[model samples]
Target: MKNFKIVFTFVLFLLFSFSNAQKIGVVDTEYILNKLPQYKEAEARLNAQIDTWQSELQNLQAEYEKKRSAFENERVLLVGDQLKLREKEVMDLDKNIKTTTSLRFGANGEITKLRSNLVEPFQDEIYSAIRAVVDKNGLGIVLDKNKDNVISHLPRYDYTDKVLDILLKGSDKKEKTNSKGKK
Candidate 1:
């Protein structure tokens, strides 16, 4: 079903390209992002935050394990209320660990939220650059090279470098303006 849609889209693209005599361009966004220093920095920051969260989770897991082991060892000596209290403590710790994990790494968790926040600006910048490149070259269709559907395209139609160049130029201008303002 997906393949059929891709083929249909490709056919339509070809029809549009030939019928209108308009150019279709492709871009490798991954390549562009890798070349972007700001994206690299954002990725690094995200990774660092992930590492810290992982460490915290590990510590909680270790504590849970320790308490669980202690509870098992003292099971024979503990009375009804004492055993219940200890079991409750262990269970509470387990619950706390699960909650923490979910809050930090779940589908709608802190990591997902942070990643979206961090990457959104870069996505906007890339989109703007791609739009500018498409407009400047009068391209009717712009396909992402990263998509599996884009099987092959001519080198001439590959506008990845042009988009990256625009992004780099924009950043350079921003840096110059920033530096001038600081001085």
Candidate 2:
């Protein structure tokens, strides 16, 4: 009976201590991004750019294949410096294709740069909106519910709509301000 009382008292004490603590909130960044029109447009533009680059890479590879086949067939027929020059041409074309591919789509390449340029602005806006919500609500912590380790959370604790609201509201305010300033 005494042990039960002690455990019960400890539970009550913990509850009381936590009652005054700052609240925790969760935001789904993907959900918030989806709510932003600019994000959708940026994603579409990035995907289109990626497709164009991929097609170009494919064309380069095809050209390299043709050159390689031609060189293999004529290699035995040619002799001396003529054979060497043709082989060198094929090798240089292959090297140029690899260099182009690396420059366009490799790690830390043009694709990454384009994605950053397109998406970073929306990311910044989302972060600022989340920060504003946290500061205004006196939240102690804000977790991204999109993260893998977050298995479950209460719906009431989810602040995804609040973040979207803030972002949309900010944009609306900007539009209104711009219109008024024009007149």
Candidate 3:
């Protein structure tokens, strides 16, 4: 189904491309992001967070294993109430670890939220820059070459560098404003 969507989008892009002599532009958002220093910093921060989460998860798993091992070792000698309590403690710890792992790493989890928080502003800026580029170029259709939407694209039609330039210009303007205020 996903492949079908990709193929369909590709077909539409080609169709639109050949339909008229109107200029069609291609923007690679990934390339644009890669050029931004801010994106690199955000990526580094995200990687650090992922590393921390992985270490924390490993510690949790280790703690769970210890509790489970002790419970198993003492189960034979434990009386009714004591055995039940030990069993419950082990079970609860296992459950807690699972929940914590999922909360940190699963879909729509904290890591995902953090990633979005870090990347969304960059994406928005890219989008706006792409729009400005399209408007300036009088583009009829814009296809993303990065997502396999285009099997091949001519260098002439690629507006990624132009869009990146616009994005950088906007970033420069912001920096100048911020510096002026700071001083």
Which candidate tops TM-score? 1
Local accuracy of candidate 2 as per-residue lDDT tens digits, 23-138: 98999998888888878988998899899999988998999899899999998999999999999999998998889888988998899899888878988998999999899888
Candidate 2 has its poorest 10 consecutive residues by lDDT at: 143-152
Q: How many backbone clashes does candidate 3 have?
A: 0
Kindly list the per-residue Cα lDDT of model 3 for residues 82-121, writing each as its tens digit.
9999999999989988898889999988999999999999
Give the per-residue lDDT of model 1 (tens digit) for 67-145: 9999999999999999999999999999999999999999999999999998899889999999998889999899988
Q: Is candidate 1 or 2 superior in lDDT?
A: 1
Residue 94 lDDT in model 2? 93
Residue 88 of model 2 has an lDDT of: 94
Tell me the whole-model lDDT of each prediction, alpha carbons only.
Answer: 0.94, 0.90, 0.91
lDDT at residue 37 of model 1 (Cα atoms): 97
Name the Cα RMSD for model 3.
10.5
lDDT of candidate 2 vs native?
0.90
